[model samples]
Target: MTLGTLTWVRALDFPELLAPSTRTAIEAWVAVDPAVADAVLVTEIDPGLADTAALTEAYALPPAASANCVLVAGRREGEERVAAAVVRATTRADVNNAVKRLLDVRKASFLPMDRAVEESGMEYGGITPLGLPGRYRVLVDARIATDDPDTGPTVIIGSGVRRSKLALPGALLARAPGVEVVDGLALG
Candidate 1:
């Protein structure tokens, strides 16, 4: 499978490439929607190049077709609310306003690295939307699924491990389990 400038293989055939929880979630999702196994592709890479910017540059991936999953959290009524914002690598998540409003919290900030990694059960640089704590809401930017010819149709995201990455149609990811597409979720 070819996505961006990298060649990937069916993630279903390479469960070892994904983290434990991520693989479980993908397997479960595939059980419900078998298409996921075929559509979601994975490829191994240098773990040091896992960061969005570094990966994009190293692999010649289109900036717009590469998505970043960021974990953000805030407290509302003493209850900690966490969310994973999936946005394009070219833009930033609107954490101050859009996210704060959506979360219904006075303020929002990036979840601490330790907490994010521990609770999500995924590596810090490889947090993907495929698997996350059930309590965490997934807020995908509206542009993620937009038919932008310039950006191509597929999007590359984390594989829950820094050594590999996953790619699939942005539209498919938007409809993933527990995902909510939100307009204005990204800031220019």
Candidate 2:
């Protein structure tokens, strides 16, 4: 179904109910341009948890056809801090070299799920790069932007639920505010 058809799953109004951190980030991105804000499409699905395999089957997607955006945080050798990075499902973030250089940290690592949830204010399978604290750098896999006749021009992303997903244009995601296009962001 088209994004417009997706149901808004939250119990409260979209603005009032979203986690504070998510709401704040979304609002700021919206302020960048009306189109960016308009792209958000929310929906409800079974809260059932699933790894990549289950998600792909439930969504009728091909193997390795999904894009996973992981949130990472850690400290550099000299500085005390936390940082975040986004990478696709097919590949892991180059934490050792590329990501460290990008984040300007001597070292970087994955943020545990609990911490990611706390900092993002978004439910675990629901986090999308569209709305994130501006502090983190958003990265997208160039391959995800390619057109596939079967899948249309959209890329499947979390629908704030484990059972369902939201599909939107990769180009749109690349253009969203706070998103930074990083070449070689993901490895096959």
Candidate 3:
């Protein structure tokens, strides 16, 4: 299916693009919010081109239309807190300051690949906020939470696996369960 300027393959055709839990979450999301029923678009991609920089360049998508999800972990008292920070590819998430304060931890750093994969049930380079555990907080940078017509209504994000990518509206993402819009969440 082609919507506007983007071409999308049906998400159901590519099981590898979705983790089992993510598929469930997406189904539930669409079921509850019929308005965003057509918000998600899936496109086949080379696993080698999974990273935002390569994916955007190869697909002719502007950097502004690409978003990256990073998993960060911090320890406070006796518990560990982890969160997913979504930011545009051009900027970095303020993990040490904004995120740490948000998580109420002394320090926050990227979670180890092994732990992130084991816990999130997602591929290392493709861990999206869609299927994160309930305990995980999802922080969306303000730039992504606010849509811009010049960049289109959608941003390309990881599809839980490297073989495909999911293009979804920023507004839809902001409305996702557990997502919090954070201003100055990313460093300019």
TM-score of each: 0.96, 0.73, 0.92
Arrange candidates by lDDT, highest first: which order? 1, 3, 2
Backbone clashes for every candidate come to: 0, 1, 0
Candidate 3, residue 176: the lDDT equals 90
| lDDT of prediction 3 | 0.83
TM-score of 1: 0.96
- lDDT by residue for model 1 (138-185), tens: 999999887557777788899999999998889989988899999999
Worst 10 residues of 2 by lDDT: 4-13
RMSD of each: 1.0, 4.1, 2.0
Global fold similarity of model 3 (TM-score):
0.92
User: Taking the tens digit of each residue's C-alpha lDDT, what string does model 2 give over 53-127?
Assistant: 566565455544456777866566665454444555556667777676777776677778898777766678767
RMSD of 1: 1.0
Per-residue lDDT for 77 in model 3? 99
Q: Which sections of candidate 3 miss by over 4 Å?
A: 1-6, 10-16
Model 3 C-alpha lDDT per residue in residues 1-188, reported as the tens digit of each score: 55334579656555566877678778778788865556777887788988877777777788888889999989999799989999988789999899999999998999989998999898877888888889999999988977765677777788888887888888789889779999999998
Choose 1 or 2, whichever is better by TM-score. Answer: 1
